[model samples]
Target: MMMKNVSLLLFLIFATSLSFAQTDTLKVKTDTGNVKKDRKKVEFGPGKTHYAYAYFNFMFATPPEEGTDADIFYGKSHSISYGVRYRLKLAKFFAVGAGVNYTYYAWHFKQNDNKKIPTSIIYDKEKLKINALEADVFFRFNFGKNKKSPVGNYIDIGGYGDRNFSTKRQFTNYINDGNTTGYSDYTGINTGLNYMNDINYGAEFRAGYGSMLLFAKYRLSDMFTPEFKNEISSTELPRLMIGFEIGFHK
Candidate 1:
């Protein structure tokens, strides 16, 4: 009976040890899995922090003409603009951005039929240019739930108050006189006002790893100059512009 009791006691001790060992193994495995899950979460987060970026834009208006040959008369129309943007996080899905942009416009007009023109023609005998400059402060709205976008897309809307400060406006006029000559010394005048302020509204779509941006703007002011001639009248037209911006931002 004593031997039987001893054997029974030993058996109970062994079973208890086995049970404790199994519980310890399970606890260790659970802790290891939790640690691995935590590491993975730390390695890959939703997005990145907000950043300040310096931006530049070269914009061109759509050619007013349809025919390919007509494009030659319109000349090279382009604008160079540069600015800096500050992004302030207002919420998880929204941010406020303000920036300053300085823009320059280059308008060129070239002569097509030189041989059919007169030397005395008071029109553009050579290439002429108009330079327009503007300083603007803008507010931008960003679209996306996350700041760091894996899908790589954003939309921005902004407005700028701009001033055109230059002394000359470029001009080119075809000689209306009914004459034909191979050469003419007359060309268009570069005439500009002292200071003209205008307001512009624009929107931009950005994507492609920060290399592509499509933008459009409309100036709500009538770009006009007072005519010195008594018979001349004031000009009125809404300046419409649209272009693509291709560059990088860091």
Candidate 2:
């Protein structure tokens, strides 16, 4: 009876030790696997990622080679645009992006022999302003070595479509009768021009380093409606624009 009791006690001790050893080994493996997964989650690269950014551009319109009806003062004719974009990096060197932009164009006209050009009334300072909302898509090509972040040199080739929401004509002139040496100024503003086109499309090109870029655009559509082309001057506004852009990102 004493020998059988001793043998039973030894058997229980052996089973308990075996169970504890197996539990400890499993715990160690699980902890090691969790550490490896955490390290992988924190690693960053410039592929298969998406980000959003905002940009602002200052643009200048190039002179047209057409008739005098579209002649404008080079320094005063300018455009300002701002937009936000989202980009998807498909590979280490390629990306696709889309954006929405708002652009304001001001064309200052010079005095011409024909007073009916752009507007019926002629003034010392005449400006034709247009407000537009634009949607654009582009493909980007990155250069140089890849880094942890997406800041690098890149070039973009794209196209854009615009909706002209507002069109206006503004004029200002100095008025002075034989009265005093001080002269009074006269200003007038007209809105909703029927001659203007409501839709416009263009091709865009951009080159940049980090957050700064230079851009050029060429309009592929006409600037005036069919009625204006038939009755009024058939001349079109400047189609080329050159600008510089600054981007914001994290």
Candidate 3:
């Protein structure tokens, strides 16, 4: 009977130990899952935070020709873009970001001089420029099975507001008779008043692989303001841009 009792006691002890061991194992797994669920951002590496970035871009616009008057012609040249952003990792795979940018827009045009007499006016050959300060807000998404890959892919979709602060035109024109009496000069014109809207709002999309990106922007607002519509009777179309963006993040 004592042997029987000893065997029973040993069995109970073994069972209790096994039960505690199983509980500990389950607890460990639960803790690990919690860690993954609560993680806010992708761990790129030590000191490689993705919350901030800077980029330089060269772009071109599809000039709007509709609002142009009978005498004004619009064409595009080169555009330079540079910006910096700050982002908040709201989830493991997503963030909301905002930043400021500067864009210099260059254009070429054949314009009829507004101030010159129509009878004497030949077309004015002009180089035009508008520069602005802009602000953007976006939601960025990160993807791919290999998050550690230095070359990766992501997407950013956002809206931007651009306020043109400067505008100028350099022109050369001869008489309508195609004679040799031509004049060339530089003039600072109010681009916002005569050609472009003072305020432009647009939608932007960027898809990136590594440090390179393809971007497209579409202006939702009219190219010219209400007051300027009468001046540029044919200039009411929206502007668009598609180009590449390259830079780095810190």
Query: Please, what are the lDDT tens digits per residue for candidate 1 over residues 5-49?
Result: 999999999999999999999999999999999876654322333
For candidate 3, the lDDT comes to 0.68
Report the number of clashing residue pairs per model: 8, 0, 6
By lDDT: ranked, best first: 2, 3, 1
How far is 230's C-alpha from truth in model 3 (Å)?
2.5
The whole-model C-alpha lDDT of candidate 1 against the native structure comes to 0.50
**Which ranking of candidates, highest TM-score first?**
2, 3, 1
Kindly report which residue stretches of model 2 are placed more than 4 angstroms away from their true locations once superposed. Answer: 1-48, 146-149, 177-181
Question: What does candidate 3's lDDT look like per residue over 3-55, in tens digits?
Answer: 99999999999999999999999999999888886563554421234467788
Give model 2's clash tally.
0
Which prediction has more favorable TM-score, 1 or 2?
A: 2
User: Residue 154: error of model 2 in Å?
Assistant: 0.8
Give model 1's TM-score versus the native structure.
Answer: 0.52
Q: Global lDDT for candidate 2?
A: 0.85
Per-residue alpha-carbon lDDT of model 2 for 9-68, expressed as tens digits?
999999999999999998999999999997665443333367678999998988773555
Per-model CA lDDT versus the true structure: 0.50, 0.85, 0.68
